[model samples]
Target: MDQSLKSPGQSALEDAFHAMFELTRTKPAPTLAERLDRLARLRALIANNESRFEKVISADFGHRCATETAIAETLLVLGEIKHAAKHLKKWMTPQRVPTALQFLPAKNRLIPQPLGVVGIIAPWNYPLQLTLAPAVGAIAAGNRVMIKPSELVPRFSALLKEVISTKFDATEIVVTGIEDDISQAFASLPFDHLIFTGSTRVGRLVAEAAGRNLTPITLELGGKSPAIVDRSADLGEAAERIAYAKLVNAGQTCIAPDYALVPEASVQDFAEKVQASMRRMFGTDPANKDYTSIVSDRHYQRLESLVTDAAAKGARIVQAAKPDDPAWKTKRKFPPTIVIGVTPDMTIMQEEIFGPLLPILGYKDATEPVSYINRHGRPLALYWFGKDNATRDEVLARTVSGGVTVNDCLFHFTQINQPMGGIGASGTGAYHGEWGFNNLSKLKPVFYRSPFNRLADLYPPYGAKISRLEKMLRFMS
Candidate 1:
């Protein structure tokens, strides 16, 4: 907040922001060929640097499964690239709009124009995917990009610098390492558009900073995402899907199932099924080669404390995997845990448990689950496991979240065609495919008229034609 503390680096950052604006404003708009070329270059960059990205993520996390990195990070980024490339032209096309009868002889259309430089602030979890995914959309919209990867993932951040520097011009796309001061300065810059992915606390800061400049922002933030399991749902399948999602990235994902609302009658059965699924997935030894470790010990300790505190408060702590289990004692490893009989006062129920701790709250009926979700601040994602179409529809209609998956979790985010973002407390704005392009571009309305058809009668001040035009407007209305 202090300008006096602003270092030369901060001054350079500001200059960079101004230079980007100048470049976008002064340079001729990119041709379709140039946009296509940029996409190709980005694709090549991701493909060529895939291995390096994986290695960097693995090094940063110290136990990130190579396969997980490839699937979650590499595949996701590549998929976004493919989606953006396939839809870029369609998204960029100026859409013709029907002119009102009142505005006769005029043609109107919505033109999609780039918003110049866009600043993307990415999160530490899934660092490569989150950072590059939005970048794909920003580039497809024909806007320059500046990326600030989280400091927690220093290795991947460094790798991004290398990859982006080699693949893109500084004025086109640039990646910067995380410095608190630099990040603050970067967020405060008057970018044409800014997209941030992080926690709600930081999202507020980013939104405030963007507000100061009257710049538009897309905030992708996380909250206590909940999974609802009804009486009619398949307990086994629901448990398996929930466990799989909860363990993915050791539950560091923004859209991971934070907790669950289960039918009271099926609570015990659901817990057993979840535990069985955990055992099956990790082979009773999650610390083995296949499973992932927590990103840091701090996260592990926080998870441990949450479990400890909940258990102390008379909540039932059900260990899907035991403490003596290989998964438990391993460095940065917290086994899939479930806390039942959880009251609203419990820590597990109150906070966004960004770990593999799934708290199950028993409910009397489907309505209770919907009510519970609605009572809480909307989450980044919501999950429902039910075969009944009516039940699924009911849940979908009743609950609000950034995204939803009918019988699974986190997969909805994979669909680039649909808009992905939070409502209310979860976050704001969406970015993916066409939505992402639109987020980074301004849809300016354009109107054209033929001089030959200009209506002179309506142009006169308070003439008899005005009454006639008013009648016509009333009729149209």
Candidate 2:
């Protein structure tokens, strides 16, 4: 990495990292007051520009739902900032731990220290929330932050950069350019910690680059998260909730239910209910502002292909809009589609469907869904819907996912106290509220030795006295 041959984006990134690294060395731990001030500035930045952010994000997506942006992006970030600001003092305090009886006179404490500069690589979906929420935790832990917003949402990314520049110093918190060169170089920087939110395919690249620098990462990747509809579950209730979750961002959500698993007898009924629910919520019009369009033409075409592939493979394609409807294609609005009788070989079932398309699969018994999920890579989120406590408990215990909502979808992520992350193929590491604070902060343990402790007597000079102590220790154990 010679400076002379480096791209402008790489050079700028190196400069930013060096400046922030130097600042961390000079003033590593910011005071409580300083941290609170930073949080306040972030709060004001979001509050003052809420409307503008909504508009820019919509422009980026062609037609992003305004209410969805407010709820999923702006509101979530504001809530995270408020949570971090309120409980920061308690979160930052050192904790006491019990000492072993062998070292009874010593004291043990765990201190939380900042991890210096944190880098966040955000995706275009929910750009504001995904980018700033992790920064909230890093800032709360008193660390400098650098964010690389998605290139897909150029308007939103540029607006974020300009507004962030106005409120904070570059070294304190900066938004990097979303150039291709910048994106490629961002993960390679030797950050103290990195947070990436995107598909599993790109998460691997980011993780590999970060691994070279031994930088810790919190990856929020997507997967084929499933919604299990138990036989005892209320079909109407489950359908409405899952439908809302699937269509919220036009199914661009990472944790959105990728497919549904219903009992064999109820498969057709559940599919109809879900389709009806989708129509009721978003309606049959592509021009409906309440409905959001796919982020780009490429993404829209991909969704169309998934539906086409499923249909060609003998899977039922239920849609509110016809496949060749020019209105939907021109507007980049993907018709809410439900795929029935999807087989494992279908491309739609083989990959994560980050669109409004939902595949409805039927299971023979309670154990079939669990086994099916286990056979594939673990999902980022899992949804179980049923009133039977025994069945719900069994499903929860048998399945291993990043997180779970017992009878709902996407609600677990909103709980600030809970860790929002995935496992294995879904993601690696967790963050949100105290979980985020602790993950970004190093919990260094401090042990205080008392002058009167007798443990030193057993060091070296082995003899009868040490032998007698060992015998006593064995007896105690």
Candidate 3:
């Protein structure tokens, strides 16, 4: 692309990168007071504009419930800011470590320092939380940030850009909502560190682009996260919790339960209970108050294609709410759907169903679900619901996922102290609380020698004295 023809977003991103790079060269890391000031400004900006966030996000989605935005986007970011503010002092302190036995009387410490510039590519599902939560961590760690929010949610992105422009300087925290070409261009920049949260497909592109610059990256990619219901589990409570987690944001969350594994005999009963739970939450018609629409027509059609393909491939499709009338086609709202008799050959079974679709498969033993989860790439989140400690421990010990929630769903994400991220294809590295601070900072190691050090005897040409000392050490060993 020609430089003159570059989109404004692309131009601004290039400018921000240069500006931040220059700023960091002069002021490599902000002081504790400066960082706290930036965080305070961010908190004030979001807290004061809660209503605007709700309104803009609702406009971006056809009809997003205000409370959902309050809890997921605005409130979650606020919590992250408060948590970072409280812990930044401790997290920034140098950690003293014991020196190895070979280096007696030497001092060792790990000092945390900020990386120069960080780039965050946010996803559309939870735009505010994904975009600003990372910024909070970066600022707390004293790094400059450039955010490229998803273009699918235009109103929310514009509003976010406005908020950032008003409250933050470009070199401090820059935000952009650009076209795909510009996003690709932004991803190619040589940032000190970068974080991208989206599909594995696009995450691959971003990862490849960053790799060219040797930029360290954290890719929060999606996968088929599973929930297992052991035979000894409470079926009704499990169904209700799983339904609420899966249907929130219309199953747009990256960590939402993608499928459920139930004991063979209770499959039908569990499915019925999930249906009832959905009805209680969103009535028979799945009214707008609690249900959220698909983000775009393209995503809606892709979800529709998955359903049609699964149904054609001998899968039993069931709605969690009411009839799957065609009227929902125009409204862009899809019901919480359930699928049974799902086989690996079906499209729904293969892809990460990011919409309001759930597939329940039956397993004969506790080991089967573990084996199934192991066969696929590691998931971002896994859920296990049961009273049996043996089964819970077995699953936890056997399966590898980014995180786990027991007897419920998504509560693991709410714990700010724990790190949230994926392993293998799902994601790498974690970000939250103190972990977020350390992940974004370079913990440099320092070793100090005392003035009375006696190591000079071993430094020369390994003479008789060194040989004698080595022999004495060997005898002690």
Candidate 4:
């Protein structure tokens, strides 16, 4: 149906689409100044609502730390906005290219233009950052944006909607709440581009829906990312970093270290250090206020099931908290856990464990881990810990992952200059920094024909002259 003739009672999805379409028709390409203005507004909105955003997101999670919110969500987006604002003018400028000798009087240039409407669908984990960071890129490219945040985090979702609504015009940016069937319609809309960040299962469905509209999409899906501990590594420091990365947000992160490949002889030592690190970070059983709880009861049960299935399959389950600790009884808090002797038949190894569960797989050599990683789908991130440059180089060259962090974990995602994304099953396409601006924009090529051109010499009357010109052109370079 023609959007212009849609019914009065059309779904809210239609309203958002029509609003952005009408607005784009009025202002096809925003000026650089206009783009900067939008980014500035986004930064200010987060700056002004830092405390409230922390409070609401904590309410969404059982209890998220205000500092974590500030660092992961608020500060991250703020830094992105600043980076974009500083370089957007350069990104938007037309780039010149060399014209071929055959077209001596012609000039070539590439123009970057917005792709009308960009739709961003974010997940429950890192709700604020996932939703807004992409918006920062789309806005930098001067596209009208519509964001759909996960409904599971209702408090953050509602607050995000409220914040965007209060600070932005409906035609410029719209935030939609999770309204069941209406969301299906949102994905199927003929958007210029779409970005979905979540599970690989849902990513397939979203891709299928967008395919019907011939809409280009960017998928930021999750996978079982791994951390490799080499023979020469500082085992204690590796355990500390890995534990912090896994336990943050209760391991409800897309790039969290899902498992580790430790040297066979040092597996027990590494595991012990990881337990001590967990104790120091969250006290006994993670009862401290700093540790975040599972986002929902359903997820809590799912994590429990992963642990139970693994244990039933002969995996040795080590509890960081005291046995039968009351912390696990809570509807939200799932204590830190580490699994050993895990096999491929177990459920934990088969899927991306999006909770506080870590599996330590023993490896005899560096190539063993590389071969193991290659056997499965590509991970979103990979971590290597060791001072042996030769071993690190071999691991780096032998394995393929979306991104890598050397001697540490999860911090590779902090570099705004580097593009952050997944590969193959983990995800498709990339974004962040200049990569994002280019992803959302269409880099169109324009050629100028000089009036004094001699192309008429080889026109339709082509015979000997045309043959000579073609042959000469082939060898001209």
Candidate 5:
């Protein structure tokens, strides 16, 4: 569609898309030096504006923890850039495959080529990492990139646009406006690939739109990712890790342990330990700098409704702080809460709890956790804390998830060599390090045939030679 005929935000998105699309068409493959330079510039952009990014991201969140921002956003992004730059050369090189004995002297090479113009639709939570991490791969793969950051983080989005614009030509890379009108149009563009990181509900819409253009998509969607506390696991250690993972960014993390499945005998003790850990780390104080506020009033209310519904349904409400206290609500910081005696009927159990709320459910035996998880949609991440190698291996083998982190929480995402993505409803496709580069590039297979081959003899009129050729093929098979 023409820019003049569309909404202002849509028009701007169209302009950016066309510009990068045209550039990619003209210069399809970017040299190794060019890719490394882009990665370096991106690193510098984050490094130079570390404080500014932190400040705006916090402002967007009402009050995000500075340490969390540094560790989760800035530091992770820097690590990705460093990793991509270091391994890009090897990733770009083609691999040789063995040729068939019948086609002697012929060769097979899988060449990696740039897929032009990759579009990224980033979610508000972990905005920086989700937005630029994919770009690192696209850039390393030699594709022009476009990003549409969430409108929820307007301050960070605007700043990102400003900084990215200064470092890159619009045709090389562009951060489009986050205005509402731009959103629907952004997904409809025919890009070589599209990546959307958010809830599964919206992921469906993005996937549907991308399907129309036959645009390949990578969805990093969230679901009710669970952490199982095995009978053999240390209660204190498991509680501490799950507590930190759940409360980080006030549990807005996509892979945050949505609930804990503990053995029936240890459920109460484990839940209390987790509550203690939450108090020890972030504390009950509404003004605690370590605690983060909910992103907006709407999200805050949704969380409140979940708690209220759970309480009304007869579940025990365990709070690190006084739940009725006005201080937490006033600051938009939900009191660190844990819900117990939760049944499948409760609203909290039905949906992805993207808040600081953790529901502790007891399992009858080791087999129950695996069976329960199997009954639901596949989750993006699953964590099992235990020392029992046999039991752990059984759970790992029986259930499927996008990724698994045994004995810890959220560490699977930090491994640069590993592919970070979800499976089924939680998400689709994977990317990080070489996985990202390969996902963004087309690994085209090229076969070289030698002129001296006699296979063409069978292509003519049928004769006794044809029978001989059939016998040879059968022998090879």
Candidate 6:
């Protein structure tokens, strides 16, 4: 936490607050074309700074793959910008509604209005994408934005501050790099809408702070997202996809499959296949330059502790490869770890294992696995690997989550049309594509009446006319 950075962040936030207020209150609402142009500019800004963003992320995380940054952050942000640009006009247009027969000469419409200043608190996992994605929606909705990138990724945070400061003014868009206290102060600011993406614990604190101002929030929190493997599923493909998804970014993804529920008869077989796939992906040594390392030493220690605690409690630990060199340990490079026979009482099962440790639980039947999933708080994402459409439909219909994928993992979120959000504890509110625009805009209903159809009879004091109006209402109903 640099004092110099903190000071500028505070000043930037205040300037952003005033700027947003002025833009929302005084500036004429931007037309659909204007909104699209703004999004286009954002796209160019991100594309132009892609290399710098990747470099900053790599410096922050120690070994972030540039390709991963492109796919997860840069490309994703660009895609969001393009999606918003394509749909802005239609999303912004006022929708006409049917007027009641009693108000024959009246017309009704639903108009969307921007919610002024929107604050986005993004986590370090996907720093650039998370910050820019929501900001795209806010801008597309004709609102100003202030972004607070996680201090954990200091290099990326600094890079974002530089890029944003150079590209846009504080009134239109701004980014902050600050310490914990400064972060808290930024969260406490009264914004029209706020979006925070992080762990559920921190999300609760953010929600509490935002509640003070009655600010609407879109919380994108992570939980123990599960992957269920049915007896009839293609074990080879499932193992490959699941392994790729879990090991990507060293399993730091919010929507990555945290654990698997495999059939008792196929547990051993699935484990073998998963181990083989892991070897193919990362080879015998995951410490090689090809593999991504844990974000920091603190997170590495946390994962090690979880593994140690689980092992002491009689959980079987299996690693994809053995670490033969001292360099691996010092670099915080953890091999893809799989734990078995884990009980609900274990620490790994109790908390979100946001690392490379994947747990496998054996169930006697599909019903048992489904019951187990339902017993837990709804997750942000659910992955089911099966071929039967009926079985998939049954699970889909019964299971509750923010998003779901059939015969795959973590890909549902890539679709721009489908809404992504969670039920119960995972999170609240959906944002992406049209959903994003809707989240930042207020839909106000308006009714217009013609002088010819001004029903004065119904406006008078209660009398025989009221009875006649009631009769007419009944008829219309």
Give stretches of model 3 more than 4 Å off. 1-9, 320-326, 472-477
lDDT of 5 by residue, 1-477 (tens): 654689877877787898888877886598999999999999999999999999999999999999999999889989999989989889888998999988888889999999999999999989898899999999999999999999999999999999999999998889988877788899999999999999999999999999999999999998999999999999999999999999999999999999999999998899889989999999878999999999998999999899999999999999866544688877889999999999999999999999999999998977999999999999999999999999999999999998999999999999999999999999989999999999999999999888997778788798988899889988988
RMSD of each: 1.9, 1.0, 1.8, 2.2, 1.2, 2.6
Task: Name the candidate that leads on lDDT.
Answer: 2
- By summed lDDT, the worst window of 10 consecutive residues in model 6 runs over 320-329
Give model 4 RMSD, 1 decimal.
Answer: 2.2
Model 2 lDDT, residue 405, Cα = 94
The lDDT, on a scale of 0 to 1, for candidate 6 is 0.85
Q: RMSD to the native, candidate 6?
A: 2.6
lDDT of all the models against the reference?
0.84, 0.93, 0.88, 0.88, 0.92, 0.85
Per-residue lDDT of candidate 1, residues 126-149 (tens digit): 988888888888888889999888
Task: Give TM-scores for every candidate, taking all chains together and pairing residue i with residue i.
Answer: 0.96, 0.98, 0.96, 0.95, 0.98, 0.95
Q: In lDDT terms, how accurate is model 2?
A: 0.93
Q: Write the per-residue lDDT of candidate 4 for residues 128-232, one digit (tens) a residue.
A: 899999999999999999888898888888888898898899888988868775567778888999999999999999999999999999999989999999998
* Each model's backbone clash number: 0, 0, 0, 0, 0, 1
Worst 10 residues of 5 by lDDT: 320-329
Q: State the weakest 10-residue window (summed lDDT) of model 2.
A: 322-331
lDDT, model 1, position 350:
81
Residue 164 alpha-carbon offset, candidate 6, angstroms = 1.1
Residue range with the least summed lDDT across 10 consecutive positions in model 4: 322-331
Candidate 2, 142-169: lDDT as tens digits: 9999999999999999999999999999
Supply the global lDDT for candidate 1: 0.84
